[model samples]
Target: MSKNPDTATQSSSGVPPLNPADQKRRDAASTLGNASQSKSSPEGVKEGGELPKGWEWKTIPDLVTDDGVFIDGDWVESKDQDPNGDVRLIQLADVGDGVYRNRSDRFMTKAKAHALHCTLLKDGDVLIARMPDPLGRACIFPGDKRLSVTVVDVAIVRSGNGEFDHRWLACFVNAHPFRSAISGLQAGSTRKRISRGNLATIPLPVPPLPEQRRIVAEIEKQFTRLEAGVAALQRVQANLKRYRAAVLKAACEGRLVPTEAELPRRSGVPPLGSAKKRQDAASTFETGEALLARILTERRQNWLARRSHGEGGKARGQYKEPAAPDTTNLPTIPNGWTWANGEQLFSWSSGAGLTQQDIQEGNYPVYGGNGVTGYHNAFVAEIPTLIIGRVGALCGNVYLTDGPAWITDNAIYAIQTPSCVAMRFIRLAFTRAELNKRAAGSGQPFVNQRMLNETVIPLPPLAEQTRIVAEVERRLSVVEELESVVSANLQRATRLRNSILQKAFTGGLR
Candidate 1:
């Protein structure tokens, strides 16, 4: 038996093409019938499986109109652009995942655009990027006021008939299932990409026109709420950072806790220059100036002792005392507090170099510019100390070690803390000093021993240093707790966004 001519011309899928009016009625009927039959279908619909009733799986080419077009963009190098060009060039950066971001500023003359035969973008045209961050991510091109062309590797899809909503299609492309399918088909070992042919072959879930509109509306409504919550969370994060800086600023300015000048009689300590008279006094509170004097005396004694013991026999020259800090530009401190250079409070030493080959899995943490980089069996500084990042971008960062550690050459360690000084208080002071401002190198910023020793710090009285450290810690602890909560909520918001997209695609939202 021979087939009829009409039947022979029809597509093998057995569905004849319908006019716009007839297609609309058929789609509505199919959607209503499916909704009634599949009310209890599984929510999770796997790709290549039976779709929810009324939803049909269509390839990219199947969804397009008879006159629809698909093409890749032009290949224009940076040197090809004319200074006074009429047509704007749209790069991948101009397209966000499911959103249009007009960041492309490159342009070429209209004559060139016509010669290149670029696909001129129009309103509601779907653009898909071939490369990753996320391969196959797509967005709808919003119409431009002027003529525009996209770069190569970007796929452009245009429908002659207004059969599909661009926003709905964009959302589907950005959702998880479509991305997963495209990811499997991506090529390249380093920078992965999906060819235009592969992209056209990927299956698309086609819901009825009315259902697509509903899904898009609900998704936008939920996204609006999610974005507001994310904005508020970000603001709280920024405020927390400012608050931390304020706490450190207050601590270093001697305003965090009461000073001996404000409460001299609280500990029965005599004022400065009366140490001889108060020798019998059992008070431990000492003015910062008094403590500085004692530290300098001890340093001289230790140097002399080393010299006599021949520990410095190899020295070539006499030691020159560091010049006193020029504190004329420094802020005025409290009465019992004094301004002193870091050299007078702690002995600074550069760390030794230890390569990756030298490091081994062991008990000691090998410190670097940022933090612990590796482990080693050897120890350099045995006592608790402050580590200052000395090289690269992390220069001037400060960290207090809990115990023995091996500090790498990329950092400088404060080895000896004077008897009257609190290490924690000095660390806090450094945090407020913004020492990175003094970094030297133009290419890679650096802090050397000289810069560390010459840095001026506001020295508080011994009793007040302890109190300030305690108060700063107490306040910061609260900030840390609040930050933890904020971070958790931010993570939750991301999960919720993903969940909404999943439900919207799976018919769960309906």
Candidate 2:
């Protein structure tokens, strides 16, 4: 009789002899059954409860053949690895929850493997990740043609027995009850890990060989359906993103709602497409050019008052005109609209520096590059102001503060805006600008006050601004509601996946 090729690598004694201390720990874990539960599980399923005839509670070691292998993976280190070597090194990342991820790419020489006493891997071997993301998750390794070995963070079990299916065992390890049990036996504080001793001792519910195959098949069949549904949900999510971008683009371009010029024409005023029509229209509606003029006058008056009170700034010399926008390459706006730079709209300044330690318990929200990162005791900006994310990945995001808030140094805000200017309109324009793309640095990109000031945007009259904001909000509210529905379904799918796994192991799958 020939020995199975899968078991050929193992010694006749099964797992290698453990040291006295390890043996003692293994014996304790095996007999006491750890937290995998003694008679019943947290899910209220009794140990081997009403298991069909021939089903039994068995430790991992008991399922192996006389020539099978049950052992911890090799303790391979980074320094021991070689890029151009013959043997592949499987890592923790390659172990997925009941699946082989094959994510790691590392190698070592054959001679190096022998020197380190590393065990070679074989197909159908169950590999368990001893450390978390959900520790003790196991998968059946579908071996590679090239020789392979895993790091010590993985444990290998090759059942070379015709009595049990490794695939079924992998599923059992991933089942909620078994994972919950392994949680109690895990060690280490900073990074949790389950020792091989504790891992080998967990009591698992094993069905008859034929039934094991049936259960594994059923689990796969159900999972395939769930995966298909999830893929559809993901596609919907992608579509929602494109729709949102389209809405913003249309809103910014005066296409989402009737343009201010068109509105004036609808009322008895002549269309402002031509300069003569614009002059002839004696419309009460303020053109963007007229609004801009009024804003600048008000801004100058405010500055003069502040200067007279010695409050504007220490370097208050004769005020110079705000810089005009460079519109040579910019898009043309509607007749009643005008192109203006941020400098013409508001005085921009960075927020004050605030660290985590400085944040105190209070009702005031601390707005940072990501908006309302934390809470603070004092507010630096009052309600109805625009905040621009100025640093890192969130750079260029626009936030409209709802209440008094503390703006962190990681953001930029309009320190002063003319009362006639609609802050909401400016926020919408900034968001549509996609400022984050203009961030300059190769690492930790940021947008400065100067960059903001130079950026050009299409501006409508204040009344039109209010109308645009209302229309955009109405459309976005509908989008948000659909997004909420999609989000809830995604979460429900996850719960359903868990429920399927829970039911499969508890004999409910039949």
Candidate 3:
């Protein structure tokens, strides 16, 4: 919401009063030179840069018409808003760098607009966001199909057919150099902002009227091409996401590599037509059920060992077996593949909590529900361990530690995974399952050891698990490399944008 400006400046004729600091910065620029040129730097006029022959340095107030308005928007509180009213309430979100975002949908009645004295917006008026995230990003206001007024945090500039171009001013404000200068003037410890008073003081680069049009056009032409390239790169990223999903689906489905059952047939084993032939082939390979049994046995022994050492907290009187998955309506798996509940594959436990003070510069990485929340001196889980996000929005997210790590209370880790299983295979399986969708609560969703213990997933033979992990890694590695290239080019595009702006203002556009 915004606060109304003084009644005297409500119409275009009056200029808003400047604060002492604003007045000082404003006076400093003019006192430095009049009609004198300096070399232009990426940081703009503040850096003492030279301008072209016809160009001159001017403050925001010097560029606008005597009748033009430069003021902050009215402070309309949420309580004053009416959703069905006729006047639209523009917000900081609606101001984009050199573009109109039109992201807010707030409105108030025409009567309310008059009562609050909110400045009504026009088509070509420039709106500047005063808050940081690169403060002082300005954009032309494209009218809401209805009447509109912006929030107090946004400064409105109405040139009212002045000697200068509003579009040029918006472009100048968005330039890298201008934003860099504005950043230093921003205040507020919690959320940085540039006051309307301070905003009025920044020195602006003004070119001859005709040159301004040419510079704006050339910048847009290059930007249009850059945007198209970025769009293409984004499409490739989207397709790669689809491709990654396909690879995971195929790997889990026994299609990515030869099945353990089929591999034997390829290696001179008898074809499986008769039951006797199938039995002979099956006996040669270890089945998923057999592998799971070995894992469960190892987990039981570890628990017993911990209990004997008085380490396993709140030990039960008796040892309980891992639960079997309910596979009633599940899809059929290839021969040698079996379904196992989560607990049958690995032992799950909550991680120890580590405070921010305890997390320090160390060799061990500290992990929370999200990966690598910080670094710590001690590790709670060894390298190659499977971790699952246990709480909040990230609950059910899975990650595999590359090195010894400290798992925080916000996540759970596999306390014991049999050496026979491939951790990579488990990570891929959990990812494909989209475990977050099964998380429990609407707010602060969580997955306890009990919840994970009961979740069912398909399991392949130990040998097949190794093959799947290797193949998936190979394909994903290629995707990762291409992603790196795309990422680099995206960064390159940003540099090019800034380069164009720097040239446009410094007379390098020609």
Candidate 4:
């Protein structure tokens, strides 16, 4: 216990013993000295290097003030923090495209925050994420009332002098070329991260003080207008969705077109002489009920012929009559409309399995739950078929194909449709139904053929169905046109934003 302190630290290799704490302090001082020298000396800028007149090139660390701090965030676990804790914890998710997102739900106790010695963020401080959705995206911190600390991997930057503008620096950090440089310096195989040393070494284009202010002012001015346009675009997109849903709702209610009952009844009597002429006159305005009866007769005849030929012998003993849909609580329809189960109008079957190896590039489209997944040389379903998603998040989505296509097992395909029913009308009915509400699983939502077949649909007369389809298409076409314009303008706005940033850094923005 009373041994000499020097002997306690002696090395077996005879090397001189060093104090660990003293060595750490010396290393820190050396680093700061190198940064200070690099900041003050123009020699750091290579001879004949590219720089605008009156502008200079410097490492990021050089431009920072000697007292300015560069530090990562706290490493506290989520379980240790309280929901209503006194200190807010800034996370990588709380940073967005050049703006601070105040949507964080994490918080820490004030005592715990102080114990960790976390950096207290200030207004106008710059924060950048070391990791990426996009790496190196920077935003200025908007100071808040509550005590705040950021998570590890988020770098906090503070300006040391009046020579640099924080806003301009953030914008430059998000610029394309600067991002490319960051990408090159990134480490790690899967989750890429930029080390603090590498971040400090990044080159920054130092504009004159007055120019930096002007650039920031101009960027904000342009961004205000661009954001207004984006807001308007979003409103239009939301309106389009509502309009589509409204159209489908109206079509299903038989209010989208003139019903047979709305049409003028035949005033003049049919010719008294010919029975054939009278029969033709009576058949002119066939109601949905009359049409259903005819369709059922045709289906029975077809079934009888198939049975005689043994065409579907495998299904002979497995057949079970589908129960009619309960319509006691259903809404009233027009004179020529009726509520009927989907199975009464169409036959549903699951799609056969087709692997990726079975896909062959050709004109025939192969459809999965979300829509066309690939192409194949052969098709399984005929033209004018309806496909419904049967599994996963996309379950209950519906599609109609006008040409032959392959339907993959992730969806259910309509193999038969009664002539009296318009497939387009059926598609609209399904959309209004919102079948996803009936999905059966917690992890992977799914719908079976029985569920869809049992769902009730309001059927309109043949003539009225045709008119409804035409009107819906005409209205949706206009919506589609407006959507295209809005989409194009949004894209243009993005390009313009990038162009402004490019010009600001390249001396093109005067």
TM-score of every candidate: 0.78, 0.79, 0.86, 0.78
Report how far off residue 73 is in candidate 2 (Å). 4.5
Worst 10 residues of 4 by lDDT: 1-10
Stretches of candidate 3 above 4 Å error?
A: 1-49, 267-283, 312-314, 355-357, 391-395, 439-451
Candidate with better TM-score, 3 vs 4: 3
Q: List model 3 lDDT by residue over 69-181, tens digit each.
A: 78788899998899999999998888987889878889999998999988899998989899855588999997768989989888888876567777888898898766766
Q: Model 1: per-residue lDDT, tens digit, 1-510?
A: 111112222344222333355443234223222322233322234432355678866655566665665667888888768768988888888888877888878899988887777677888888989988678888998888888888888877776664777788888888876676676557799899876655554556678888888999999999999999999999999999999999998888888887777675676655755253234324545677777777777766666766777775422256545466788889878887777887876778889898878897899989988878888998899988999999999899999888889999999998766655788998989877787889999999999988888888888877788899999999999999999999999999988987888778777775
Clashes of each: 0, 0, 11, 0
Clashing pairs in 2: none
Comparing 1 and 4 on lDDT, the stronger one = 1
The lDDT per prediction is 0.76, 0.79, 0.78, 0.74
Q: How far is candidate 3 from the true structure (C-alpha RMSD, Å)?
A: 4.7
Give the candidates in order of TM-score, highest first. Answer: 3, 2, 4, 1
* Residue-by-residue lDDT tens digits, candidate 4, 1-510: 111111234333211233455443233223222322233312222233345676665545555665665666768786768887888888898877698888877888888887877777888888988888688888888988887888878877776663688899899889765666677667789898776655665556677888999989988898898899899999989999899889888888877887665663454432222122213534356667666666666666656666778887534654444566798899988876777787777778888788888798988889888888998998999767889998999899999988899999999988776766778988888878898889899999999988888889887767788899999999999999998998999899888888788677766675
Top candidate by TM-score: 3
